[model samples]
Target: MRLTVRTNIAMRALMTCAVNPGKIVRKAEIAEATGASEAHLGVVINQLAQTGFIETIRGRNGGIRLRLPPEEISVGRVFRTFEANTPFAECFSARDNHCPIAPVCKLRNSLDTALEAFYASLDRVTLSDLTCNNAGLERLLSLEPVC
Candidate 1:
């Protein structure tokens, strides 16, 4: 299943905030660090903020910060919030009811199981799991100022 760019950027922004919990991070800095478009990230950031993943502030010291602790934030929760209402295929969507074989289709069940498994795996991991003390992330953050 392919994730939308919004989902991708939202996840990155969330992870970045998770790694630096309670620390304000500029949108431009997150965009630069994640290589996501600033314009696109703005929308995702707004969505995340609305969903209580992060809070935004205004002014010079204004930026974004996680609303909760990284250990308490699960990957599954992120996906559910950012990726909700999205489906792997047309058959998977509730709006797409034109399929004549919908009642007898085994593929839908199989896909549902696969999707559940995917979420289950994500549930096993938290934002802390993705925040490694690796050189790459350090290098990325080093190029920008941490708010």
Candidate 2:
């Protein structure tokens, strides 16, 4: 299943925060690092914050940080949150399904299995796992000099 831009950026944003835990990360910095537009970052950030994965602070000291520990934030949960309403195919969507063989479509079941495996794989990893011991990721996401 192709992940949406939101999912990609949301993971990036979370990784950015995870790598810099205890420090608040500005949206502009995240945008600069991930190459996401402010508009896209704004929407993703709001969704992430609303879901209680990350916390946001406003004003001059404004920035974002993870609310829960990185290990507690499951990647599968994040992916599911953004992709809950998204359908894998036309047959997957109840309102827009025009396929004639929707009843006997083995393809849908196969796709469902594959999608479940995908999430299950992601479920094993967390924000901390994504950034753990990865100097490159830490370097890429960090606004401060790598020590």
| Candidate 2 local lDDT, residue 145 | 79
**TM-score, structure 1 vs. true:** 0.87
The global C-alpha lDDT for each of the candidates, from Candidate 1 onward, is 0.82, 0.92
Per-residue CA lDDT of model 1 for 106-145, tens digit only, reads: 9989988988899999998987777756556555554345
TM-score of 2: 0.94
Candidate maximizing lDDT: 2
Give one digit per residue, the lDDT tens place, for model 2 in 1-147: 589999999999999998887899999999999899889999999999999999999999899999999999999999999998899899989999999999987999989999999999989988888899999998888878755
RMSD to the hidden true structure, all candidates: 2.5, 1.3
By summed lDDT, which 10 consecutive residues of candidate 1 come out lowest?
137-146
Off by over 4 Å in 2: none
Give candidate 1's whole-model lDDT: 0.82
